[model samples]
Target: MLKYIRPYLLWTLLSPAFMLLEVFMDLLQPQLMSRIIDVGVKNSDTAYIVRTCIIMGLVALTGVVGGVGNMIFSTKASYGFAKDLRSDVYRKIQSFSFANIDNFKTGSLVTRTTNDITQIQNAFSTCIRMLIRSPFLFIGGIVMVCTISWDLALVVICAIPVLALFVWFLLTKGRPLFMGMQQKMDRVNTVMQENLAGIRVIKAFGRSDFEKQKFKTANDDLCNASLKAMRMMSLSFPAINLIMNVTMILMYTFGGKMVFNGALKPGQIMAFSNYVMQILFSLTMSSFMLMFLSRAGVSVKRVNEVLNTQPDVSDGTNRDAQVTQGMVEFKDVSFRYPNSGGDPVLRHISFTAAPGETVAILGATGSGKSTLVNLIPRLYDVSEGEILVDGINVKEYELNALRGGIGVALQESVLFTGTIDENLHWGDDSASDAVIKEAAEIAQAAPFVSRLTDGYETALGQRGVNLSGGQKQRLCIARALVKHPRILILDDSTSAVDLSTEAKIQTGLREVFGDMTVFIIAQRISSVMDADRILLLDNGEIIDTGTHNELKQRCAIYREIVSSQLGEEALKA
Candidate 1:
């Protein structure tokens, strides 16, 4: 449709102009061949022969120029359109929420952006050049034949309906098969991506064979779908050839009689025969252009699906929701991922972190601790009730402003393949070296980092694989600290380090940032025991919240957790 092609209308039209010129030149060829046979050879007119030959040479040269021009235009249009579409798709992806992104696997999206877009580009290029050129040549050839001899043109016309039927058959059958091929490609991409990304997990579990079987199923599906499409495409050529060869035989049989009866010249018969074959060949090529079009129709549908999905999180009509003093409050908030029907990940959560106080969250694994913190940044919007950051609905504030006001450290740390300095700069690009060093010390990362050969400039492997788990965690903490955010979240940041090292990091942060709305999520009771307040969560709801001494008497869940870690005698004391 025009939606895809309108981006390149000027070149799209320009490419076809050259094709029309080429078709005119092609019509001249058959006429020139007739002149060579009748005037140049038969009568031995040497001057006439040279004059016609020169004209033919000029037309051939012009055809070559037009063909090159068409090719150049074709390339520009398709590549430029693809470039815009690629950027559009990527920008659209940026608009999506965590809930939206998690619905589709990352691998399938990569394939749609890359391989699927390429398929559409190829189809567009072919449609613009071949579709126009072949039709022009076929129609022009027929008109030229009619002028030369009406009886000869009739022989060509007789085969037109048969070619149309063959083309129609190919279109209806091949379209659905190509769509299946594209779907199969998505499955193949998913399996290959999983194998590559989880290679370490597979080896650790010794499940290489299981991964191979998954890949094989996807691969086999792709192969079968491709073969089915090719099988449908194969029907096109032989059917056209049968019609072409039959028409050629009829032309020879009919034209020979006219020649013997002194009605048509032998040279005219030869020219008419060449013209008939050209028409048939051009029709055959037109069929191929149609097949590419049908295949691309399916690809366009797939690309548009991604383009059309409205992001779950949108920057809507309401603007500039008030932000005041970095106060984060969760009141009866419940959040469930969109895929979940009504099972809340965090249920009836209630908390208030004053601008200058630190709140620690303690729970066992899968206790919805991280889910609670995610609300502050609005990564996944709450399914029921409201979450307020800075006295406004987190949804109402401009998303970047809300996210910018807070800093978060995830349970598992991540770092890009870059120098230590570059990783730190992700927190704040304008940070000075002294500030970065200060933050690193607060993370308990300075001692080991200063010993590295290049220190801040040392190259990190992909995802910072060159570093130990504890080192990576420390770097993540430094990245967050460099932000110096009003509201800071440490989601199990110390789980990777020794108890002594964690205590040191904790002291350094308190000394520097000083009770700046910190939320520490931890398994160790000692980590959160001395906070201004502690929230104890089980399942998705907060069961008890208090100072450690207060919770020891009131909350059974808190006592059980304390007893498990420090023993009943320690709790009694």
Candidate 2:
């Protein structure tokens, strides 16, 4: 953080320097006014009065210029600091693995990046301006008052300890409440994100009222926490004002008696009163700044949490390992989700997919089928044992190189908002038009795509909401197909398409990518029947593995699934 400030060191230093200049000009005015009243007005000297007035005007102009300079430099330093911090935080998040992301969660990270950083930025600007100016004004005013009359200055000085104690109390008690408010802000953002993402489901199930209630609950929590923190802060105004007013009254009552006794001049008494107000005003501003500082302190801590966290999954030093053959092997691999206390999702799972072979994985829901294929790309590392790609440990390959060799279309097909051609280019940005159309044809997406008014140039809504479920799935597959990877993993990506379309896609894949190793995870028995080999998984372990006919004759689970999907007569046939 300090390193970022180093670049703007000139502005950082200059801001405070100008702020001190502004304070110096402010202090000079009170003494000048006193001389005008005592030496100029009392003696009825017009020349002396005019000369003092001219000097005061010049001082006021100088103060204005110093103020403008302070504002400029302070804004440059603070806004620049925030920009660097925000960019660094975003870069750190990009480096995070799936496990690292899970630890912080989306809502908290959003709050840290946005609201927390804003808070810190505002405080930093205030610190540069008020934090420097207030102390100089307060201490300078006190010194001027002491020169007027030590006896009267004592009354002003006596109020400092009491005001300091009260301010300290407010700040100490306010820090935790402010921290709680920031946390409630995270909860509110989380509720909002979940509701927006799942709004369709909420409306389909007629749960709008339920969602509204949930949002209200989160909103109220944030409101209540905000009120609690603000309530503590609100006390500072009246309390500091009350002390200021009392100190002023004391100065007037005591100093009048001194003037009558000829111990202090009438002009001195007036100047002393002005300086007292300046001291109190500076203290009041300081108190407000302290409250803001405490809140900013909490935000600083939250931002640092992200900056300081090292990613659990780091890049490998071995950048030269090339994946030649698409041979994938899971060697006694066991895996569990990070922070999940339950048993491993895949336990002692071992399998092998030779180059140029189509191996399909069939499993019940929650049987770790998707988890199995995810290991091939090193999306998540295994809890125990190792996964190898082309006989090299997956961890040993450079992440970009490892992922670049394989193309995956996940179970939930996601489409970005773009034209059909633009979305397809994600697989291979440099792919020619002929190559894109060929990949689309292989994924069985060309028919629907051609029917649209703009054909391949048709624009899509977010997540391809304009397209039907089957159409979206096909487009995702097409996107992956454009990569022409050495290995392809389709995790039930074809489930939404009709049986005929699915069969055509499988046939097209076999013809176009006959030599590429393929891993398919599917629930439909018909989907995996033509694979070179099939593995039946149950509860994170491989229950059986064989070709279609071989599994039907010997594996009870395989037989039952085939019977359920195709009927007993069809299986017997």
Off by over 4 Å in 2: none
Q: For this target, which candidate reaches the highest lDDT against the unseen true structure?
A: 2
What is the TM-score of each predicted model, taking all chains together?
Answer: 0.96, 0.97
Instruction: Indicate the TM-score of model 2.
Output: 0.97
Q: Clashes in candidate 2: how many? A: 0
- What lDDT is obtained when candidate 2 is compared to the true structure? 0.91
Off by over 4 Å in 1: 1-8, 316-324
Worst 10 residues of 2 by lDDT: 314-323
In model 1, the clashing pairs are none
**RMSD over all Cα atoms, model 1:** 1.9
